[model samples]
Target chain A: MNLGSLLDFTYLSFIDACKHSLYPYLPKRRSIQSDRVHLEAAVSWLMKSIDKVDGNGSSKAYRILNGWMPPYPETSGYIIETLLNLQDHYGDGKFFQAASKIGDWEISIQLEHGGFVGREIGVLSRPVIFNTGMVLLGLNALFDRTREKRYLDAGIRAGQFLVECLDENGCFVRNLHDHLIHTYNVRAAWALIQLGLLSGSRDFIEAGRKNVEWSLGQQLENGYFLHNHFRKGQKALTHSIGYVMRGILEAYLLLGEKRYLDCLKKTADKFVAIYGIRRRLVSELDENWKEVSSHLCLTGYAQIALNLLKLFKITKEERYLNTALHLIDDVKLQQPLNRRSEYFGGIKGSFPVYGRYAPLQFPNWAAKFFIDALLLKIEVMRDYENSLIDKLSLGRQ
Target chain B: MQELAKHHEVFAVFGKKGIWDHLDTYLRRRNEIDVHRRHTLAPLLPASHNAHAFPGPVNTLRFLRRLGIPCYKVSHLNGAASVDLLKRLKPDYGIAAVDHMLLPAVIDCFPTLLNAHYGNLPQVKGRDATEWSILLHDHLNVCLHEIVERMDAGRIYLKENIAVDKGDDFEILRAKCQDAAKSLYLRFFERPEECKNLYESNEDGKNYYLMNWELKALAQKKVERR
Candidate 1:
């Protein structure tokens, strides 16, 4: 380690040690031994968390052990997409209303540069590529759902900023607010792909493709990608790692590339090797792909499970389906079925409640991805069964 | 390893010795490890001569068994009988796993040996490498190298530099190194010849040993300091 990294690691470790001392009574993790899937309640907890935002336009996030945080524009923007999808899937207009409010609040915070500020509501934050691209995804979804001109226009500005940040290698090489380049931008790339197609911008589409193409270079043979840095280099939380994996899978969904799917399968299979028919998934891994931490990243488990289900749908692989089913079963069991607190349905950053990722907090993105995975499970299962039904009907005819 | 197994016929050779860093968790049963230790944690644990390998290897063998691959447990991997078994199997290649160390006889038993080393050679060689990398503050690497006479001093097939980041402890760094090694090994097998030109000879490179517990705690404290 250089002097710079040495100091950085030392500082992070000190703060973490302090936190453990400070919160001795904090639960190590939320248990998921039960078999109940709390889809509605999880959504309710997220909304309740969002509604708990005090003296702000929206609740930034909910700490599993604490209360609500100041409104976070980045998450609030993306949560819009989740809420809209929930509305469409369940035919509940209430979701639409809540999403529109968040959408409007997201639009209200757009910077003069078309990017939204980072962190919670009170700081004087600058534009970040990942955050801006996330907001763009929400805006694009809002435009698609409601055909709102304001959402479309804000999304256009965000897309333009993203386009400006692109380098020749297809990476958003600028405006990281640090020296690190993240593979999680694969999710942002998924958003940009959506925006490009939605707005009919070829440049945006090409940028998304190039970003993914470059990301492929980061994949290690053990079925992992590098550049998973999130605030301390070299280490990555499975949650963000899942984000990149899902993002690449999403990219394959949009682009129809065999390489993308192949990569996704390879990575997913590695997880199956670890989970081995849905065993416990710890939050962190080292350079060698061994379990680094014992606590699970609930959101990552759900996201990866969702990807497995998606793959199973296409390939009809029982291992993929079986692993995904068991994985979801685990998450559902972990969901707070009867907790009186606001965390009643929220998925945590780390299982056992206090591992690093969110450190006893519930970010909106976790709930959002959980919702996506659950809803996706229902959709893919229905589609698969329907395909069988269609085949039967065709054969009868 | 499964990826490699999927492409070619694979067999496993087990060393009799079991290295459990935790004394409290030692196996009283001899069914697991190829060798049976007479020592027992007794009373708090149990006194059983039969021990099986750790859950990872056992579970893996179970999975592989379902796929129709047979595993042979032996006292010495490089022993004459084991060598005869390898010669009889006439396997094209062998993938040495994380826990087992191949003796010169065992390694040379096969025509070619593909071993995954947790540390980059020439700079880092030998056991407890994750600790050494952090102690020396060198960039951590996971590598696939062709086995030569000297340990970790082999023809480097491929390697990837991994970050030993903030808040990482022994387990975390070890896991990352293991993950990287698994990945690099698979990639090396993807096109075995692609790594032919990447060799570097480090006949006199320094080798590392396991750090003492006191040194480890200090280094861990340094890495985890906020």
Candidate 2:
């Protein structure tokens, strides 16, 4: 941590300590606004993020000291869903246009082997499995919307690249993050499954299933997956955990596998239990499900909230919905309403914006997840209210 | 302890006590001063209406022991010693007296763990729930639910709506909630099966955090006006 960050850490710590005792004297922080308002602001920030990359893709992050960072193809690949959802929600043509541009840009950068590179664009690296799968998500979404042959072709190529990286054990060994097998590759597996469903390719579906099955083997009795972090022997960030969870959940949805649902529910139940008891979740957790880091990973909270919402849709469980709402509200508290600042509306990488995970930057993926959660929250609330109305109407009869 | 002991075998397990350093003392004193400074609302009520005082664990233990009820202290409720204590005792159920997050290690010991939340849940959760309920929803409630790992997202057994009658301040509302909680606890011990009606509160309700003084004052005014 830098001097400014150190000072920030100290100041935040002091404030937290004094908050309960000196509650009456402290400056009042603004409470959370409506979801619609936050959604609009977050979407605006995402557009600015895309604009920073010349409308080709989304920037990796917006640093406080530096300006906009380079475009990150991995995150930009999945951001297509957000844009398309926004288009459908607001009936805005521009969002669809932006989504198309992003999809096109991802296809433009696809390596000859059909895999996308890790990290920001312009980095000299081999095609990465996770990145390729992420891009394939956008391509598959675009093909589903438009039925464009190029998008389908590109998605197939990306799916093939991912399949090639997978070993006979259903684990991706080549082009892995840090060249180690990651349980989070289940997210890649989710994308491949989507591609398979979109193109009606049994081989892609089988590859996706194999990876999920292998990833499932890594799960401990307590529902925590080993080898979930970027580097081995490190505590897994809630970010990676969210990725692994959402992937498995998506796999469950597409493949119609009871085991996948059962596995995810076990883990989700564990997470819900911990979060319920403590009323707080740390950014990093060890395999034993103990807190290894005290900092709040804001991005992870958003991603997990999204995952919980999806879980609620599958199981119709109130606990999942309630937890997801709480997580979203927690993330919303971190969002600043300073419209004049350049970083306004963008979700910070960490609480206090100087914590361990992606410190000192407003990651584009964070904003992407925040937007997705907010949109889903609205949908969930509407469905619930509509169901209530329907029930009330039925009672009159 | 006196009230609970009348119906069921009562015991106490206080949270891990901490040694106060100079900074801790200072913070506590400063907190007291800050709270006293916000005494503008106190005089609005009658002088006889003193809010419930939260005696520390030592005092509480003394009070319980005076009543001839067993009292135990654990450094950490989730610690192995606490687990061993529960294993040895093997109580039918465990009821949390204070707001402490029990781990699965400790929770698994009891066939059923119970908690009385200060506000109607699924809607109002987290800190300052009573105040948030009054401020946001214009009413206060108490939820008696199973102690699940997920914060207040537990299977609610009973929801008793506390009337925010005119002249009720924050303290009175809180006292009412406590009384309601006591009644619910007694009901549970008398006929635990009646608490089996699962109240489905699955809708996504806002988990409120601390209420700022401005909002607190507004909620107070709402209470007084009601």
Candidate 3:
């Protein structure tokens, strides 16, 4: 069972879907019509489920779900991210204006609690840790876009909210839930770590440290969770491995703790061992893999692998870097050949086809992960250059 | 008879050795008729410089005693003891130059408590005497007036209009003013009673002014104008 091959196939399928679905949204030169169609379909699907409640009433379940989407602060953070990418490719102010609109929306939606409301309107609304985390990311993006202290202040507030919500043991409590345990804790932890690094706050750093420790304690000996109650036993399914791996990888990235990395590596190894890389590749086309075919999930695994490779380079550990490079190469190779129209530049299987699966659209989450992976690669390249210089100097000495 | 008249104790109060002592030396050289000419000059010293001593009234009183003159060598006396010392000294006349603070009326009215001002009467009355003249871009003489409750509003004992160069600073103008005032003092002493009522009665007619950074800047502009 070649798990690497399976991941590669999955990566290719996902990329094809993204590129095809997201194409129409991009410039004609960069258009992947199929990807754009898929993305639009997903957005439409999500929008349909959105509860358009009156300003006076409690929001519906639809609203709750829609509210959970990115650009939560109604700010142009997501838009800015898009614009930034586009600006790099094409120097244009239209993209900047789009980014600015999103930023304005974020500022408009800021809540009195120094945390943003989860939904547009709701009496049942309490501060959700995950929503706050997303808002923090958005505010950070806004700050980068504008270099305004107001955006920084908003980011700080969100970061502070996460810090304040930590329990004595450093774990974040998921509010208004029957069970306090949830993956939101991992995200909140990750957010705190990012905020700490950005603002140089000791409290945020300490909170992150605590949450990372709690996450480590939650992992089973098999490197898989028995069940993530928040996801409601979703981990028992085929896609569960990817979801939990995402959290683990995030924790590892945030803390840079060896245990988190070791835990993720062990889990990834198990996933590969069970599915086999070849079977995983076949699974991308398999009907059963449709639900998990999103580029976001695939990108998450790739990002972990890439980050681990970075860690390996620094530690001079061959296995870590090898595994990361292998995953990247395998994924690159398995990408669909004729995916010129996919949203994610040839990634497929993100969206439902004829109601069989989710659309192969460019989900904001997927775009974020894709961008994250690209940035990680760039960082790796830079590090490689530095390492080359060091090696040459050592040779001379 | 002249030496007998000069037998009365003479006291000279000054601060900052170089300029103050220089003025004192000129006076000493000029007042040759006085048989008993006493000078009391106290150098301005910070509190930290005399840590072992009380460094305030005690040191001042001690310095005054050491001078052996009836006059006090009070250093930095902006307090109650200065008034007490003035009452104790009960000198026939008190004079001040360079020290710009107004003495209390209780001390000012003590028979003769005259101050040497560097500006002419009815004009250039306040600070930056020569600089003010330059700023007004006027060629005028410098004069010395007695220190009254209203400053340059005091009765004018003697005055001399010395032409000042446009480039002169407060210090240079001050030196010239002091030299003129010293010479005036000698002349006034010769016939003190004559100029006793030299000032006009109406204080409103007197020019009162203050020197600050803005005025200094204006003075600089005038110099640049020249």
Fnat of candidates, each listed: 0.00, 0.00, 0.00
Off by over 4 Å in 1: A1-37, A54-58, A64-66, A382-397, B1-226
- Sort by TM-score, top down from the best: 2, 1, 3
Give the top-scoring candidate (TM-score). Answer: 2
What DockQ does every candidate get? 0.02, 0.09, 0.00
Model 3: per-residue lDDT, tens digit, A79-126? 245445544534766445555555555666666666665533443356
Q: Name the regions of candidate 2 deviating beyond 4 angstroms.
A: A1-30, A389-397, B1-96, B101-226
Considering just the first chain, candidate 3 attains a TM-score of 0.59
Q: After superposition, how far is residue A222 of candidate 3 from its true place, in Å?
A: 3.3
Position A217, candidate 2: lDDT: 90
Of candidate 2 chain B, the 10-residue stretch with the lowest lDDT total is: B49-58
lDDT of 3 by residue, B106-209 (tens): 45536876666665456546544555555443454555565667646766666687656556545445545655666666666766777675644324332323
RMSD of each: 17.2, 8.2, 32.8
TM-score of 3: 0.42
Q: Is candidate 1 or candidate 3 better by DockQ?
A: 1
Q: Once model 3 is optimally superposed onto the true structure by TM-score, how far is the C-alpha of residue A291 displaced, in angstroms?
A: 13
| lDDT tens digits, residue span A1-397, model 2 | 3565456446544554454344333333346788888888888899999998888999999876566889999999999988999999999999999999999999999999899999998874678888888888889889999999999999998999999999999999998877787899898999998998889999999999999999889889898988899876778888998999999999988989999888888788777767765545788999899999777788999998899999988887756766787788778776767797677799988765667788778899999999999999888867854654554457557
Sort every candidate by DockQ, greatest first: 2, 1, 3
TM-score, model 1 to reference: 0.59
lDDT of 2 by residue, B1-226 (tens): 4677987887777655566433454443342234342334344445554353222124556777889999887776888999999988888888876544678888888888888888868787666688867755656789888877766777777778998888876766776687788888777777787666645563466444444343466567656555
